[model samples]
Target chain A: MLEMSQVSYQVGEKWLLDSISLCIQPGEMLALLGQNGAGKSTLLKVLSGECRPASGAVTLSGQTLQTLSTNRLAKQRAVLPQKSRLNFPFKVLQVAMMGRSPYRGERYQASAEVVYDALKATGTAHLSERVFTTLSGGEQQRVHLARVLAQIWSPSEDNQARYLLLDEPTSALDLIHQHSVLEVARKFAREAHVGVLAILHDLNLAAYYADRVAILRNGKMLCQGEPFHVLTPATIYQAFGAIVKVMRHPERERSPLVVWTDQTESQSIKTGKRSVSQGINKSA
Target chain B: MLTSIQMHNSPGGTSCEAMREITATHRSENVDAASSVAHVVSSRRWSFGIGLFVLLVVVAVAALGVGAVSISPGEIISILVDSLGFPLAGPLDSAYQQIITSIRFPRVALAVLVGAGLAISGAAMQGLFRNPLADPALIGISSGAALAAVAVIVLGATLLSGYTAFWGIYALPVAAFLGGLVTTFLVYQFSNFNGRTSVSTMLLAGIAINALTIAVTGLLTYMANDEQLRTLTFWSMGSLGGASWDELRVAAPILLLSIVLIPLQASALNALLLGESEALHLGYNLERVKRGLIVLVALCVGVSVSFTGIIGFIGLITPHLLRLSIGPDHRFLLPFSALLGASLLLASDLLARTFVSPAELPIGIITSLVGGPFFLWLLLRQRRRGESW
Candidate 1:
């Protein structure tokens, strides 16, 4: 399990993240939702050990994250950056093999079995022999996903749950690959008991796949919990200022579907003082 | 119940497990073909490596045989064996043995070491920058070394003669090595901000330093006396004619150490190719690796330039040519470049001797003249084949 307590990251005078605390339990997927500059990526970076928080601390399995060596931290958590820029023409298999870099000379090596299994899991097995640079954007994204999977291939001693932190992983993918990637993440979480934190822009995808949802607005948490409880129309307006209607799935009632409404009554929600009066005026 | 999500079909209407099985089946079919392709590529690289080694030996033999006092390969071998403490029982003339042992052998050995050092440094620098055009000298390292060397030659007998007099033959290389180190440190400092080195900023700083050092070298050249001026010019163009047992004794250990340290950096260099943040995420301390690479390159280039003047393009083109066929796996590329570079320099020196017999051309001119065109052709081919760097 990964836990953060009262972490805040600041740049100059602006607080990018302000006193935020969150926990990722084993065998669960948490989706982080926010607008473009809402500190979701910054929070993810702090969680991945890429950025240091201004105050408070992060712990992995009850040990302080700062005390862990880089290799130890890497073995327990795998981060998939938004884009991977490889100047040389590395083969897909070689690129995947690099995921095993931290475990050099160890018994749990990054073997061909792990690499090929990751490729197959991501549905990128056919592109194993092709040059990575020659592949298209979506294909490259899948290849990188495979690389991170191969990094923390499985749980080790003491049954520690590995964590996967992904930043906009599906932004470059198409519809089919998007669902497939999330499916892979979900399967890995449930089967391997790995904790997953993914920053997603698509609300429907997050609603369908994420076990818990956290929404951020202006570097502070607006609401978080089960999707149905937290992702209400009022919460969506407070976070995104978009007047979206929360509806149940046609067949699966537990899941929520968000639909945008184009009406003046929604416009009243933006103007704070006259919202109640304007709602009554519109009805009349 | 969370596992129930895995049973949800994708947009393609296939469950995750079913998709995995399909992908596995497809990959199994292609595995043989892919493995065969991999086998062919590795074998091709292996043959290329062996071929280069063989070519180096053949050229070394030819180099030994083709000087002004042309000795046959058999005589060369006999002289070599006799020098190894077993006088080959025969009618070998002592003068032939003296010329080969005293003059030509040291020259060939120096060429091999210097060539290998420069080429390996270049390959590592290229990998560090992640740019195909980066050479070992791109950061003004050679210019700094050249400036110090020119200063020692012009001012050693006049202003600084009191101190440098004791240094004797070892003075120039030592000064050059210090110069290279100082300049690399300066460049590294100028480009680094908050613990990260910006490649573009570093490149721009290198240009500025190169300009300043060249201007200083020009001033030293203008101030030199006629004898000192001639020495300075000869040093600038570069040659293996200055090879000696003494200089080799000082240079060989440092060059060999650099050669050993550089190839060990193959994996780190490979990680660097993925960009700095990715490398950091992969658990590499970017600052340490970058600093280590710069110091190693500076050491090799400094020692080389001190002795051979400025041998251009061997460092740049040898790696490019080898990388074209071997791919960018530096574990193989670094060693292959060392052999290919050693042979290329040896061959160029041989041509410099025989091309205008009794009147030697500087090896630097030959390298640039040959390497410049070859580099252009490689770039042209890359463009024609539509491969964007």
Candidate 2:
């Protein structure tokens, strides 16, 4: 388990994270949702051990995060930041292979196999020979996801639990890729028993894929539980200052779909166009 | 949830073990296609590395033979071998041997050392800063070192006499090293904010620091005696004409240290291209790597500038060209940059000496004349291509 206990992070007078406590267990996916500046990224940074919280603690399994060696920590967890700035023209395979860096002295063939597997999982095997900079933004995001996947591809020999943290992993991806990327994460969580924590914006997607959902408002977690419980219309309104309606998914009984209630002029125009198309279909 | 085997059997499955098994069953065919792509890239890198090393040696040897009193290549090799305590199977000319061992050898050796040192340091800096334009000379490291060296030269006999007496010959390089280290640190600190480095800010910092150092160096020049003035002027323009065995003895080990140590961080540098946090997440102790790189760059650039003056653009141009050709894998880039840098400087020094016969132009002038235009061309190309920096 990767656990944060009452973690608080502050900068000057402002609190980036206010006594936030969360636990991610093996074989589960937790989706964190929040508006911009709601401290979702800060919480991820704190959990990844990139920054020290003002108070409280983060631990991996039974060990405190600060006490672990960098290599050990790296082996146990991989982080995919929201925006990756890789200016150099490294090939796709080369970028993905960097994920195997922590496993020093591992044979090239072994690492390559893992990298190839990761590329395949992310649907990027064909891009292995292409320069990473040439890839589309969506493709680049998937490549980075592949790199992170390759980092903790297999469980440790000692059966130690591993964790994967992602900040907006699907931000640059297309709709199909967005689902595919989340599916890859869900697959890893289920099959590999790796704990996965991802910051997501799409409530419906989170509800469909994540075992649990967490919503943050003003540096504090508003709610966290199974998607149906935490993604209620009230909590959504409180967190994002927007009115929404929550409905059960037609196919998946447990999943919920979030619908925006406060429609804008453009949305009304879109609705009018849809109604005109329906009338045309009826006449035909 | 589906079991691992069921997940693997699914059409949409991307399971690792199943993929591995499938790949293993067709391992020969699959591995060939994949490894062949990798093999071609690696093989090309190897060939380029070997080719650059050979070119360096050929250029060095050819350079040793092409000076004012031209010696034959055979004589140059025999003299070099004899000096290494391995006499070739022929009688060697005494005068040619003296010229090779004493004069041309030191000049050529210094050129190689300075070039490799500058180029590797430049490559490392470019990697460390994650900016393609980062260079020792461009970022004020060279001028900073030059300022310290000029101070020691102008004041050693008067204001800094006691200090000079204490350190003797070690004073200038030491001072220059400190200056370079401080300048690099300041520029780094100025450009870095909130864990991000702005390229424009870094370049602006470099420009500002360069202006300040040049102003101070000029002030020091104003107070120099005629003899000191002459030395300072030639030194500022940069030259390897004063190359002697003693100066090489002082500068070579430091230069060699930077050349040797920078490549070890090649993997870390490769990771760093992703970003600082990414490199750290990859398990590199980011602080240690940053500190080690800064010190090594300062040690080499400072020591090189102390001896060879402010040779520009070798660092900037060599790595850029090599990166364009061989890709940005620092494992290949660092060592290859050193080799190419050595060849470039040797070739440049050769031109400096022979271009006008008996009168010699400072090697710095030649490098700048070539490098300045190359820098502009690079800028124009980058702008045309719509690259960010």
Best by DockQ: 1
TM-score of each: 0.90, 0.93
* TM-score of chain A, all candidates: 0.93, 0.92
> Number of the top candidate by lDDT?
2
* Whole-model lDDT, model 2: 0.87
Candidate 2 lDDT over residue span B135-238, tens digit each: 99999999999998999999988898998899998999898898899899999999999888788899999999999999999999899889999999876889
Window of ten residues with lowest summed lDDT in model 2 chain A: A263-272
Q: Measured by TM-score, how close is model 2 to the native structure? A: 0.93
Docking class of 1: acceptable
lDDT for each residue of candidate 2 in A1-284, tens digit (9 for 90 to 100): 99999999999899989999999999999999988899999999999989989999999987888898888888889999999988888999999989988987876776777787788778777788899988899889989988989899987677789999999999997666677788789888888899999999998889999999999888998899999888876677567655567898998889999997643322323123433334334323
Candidate 2 DockQ category?
A: acceptable
State how far residue B291 of model 2 sits from its true place (Å): 0.3
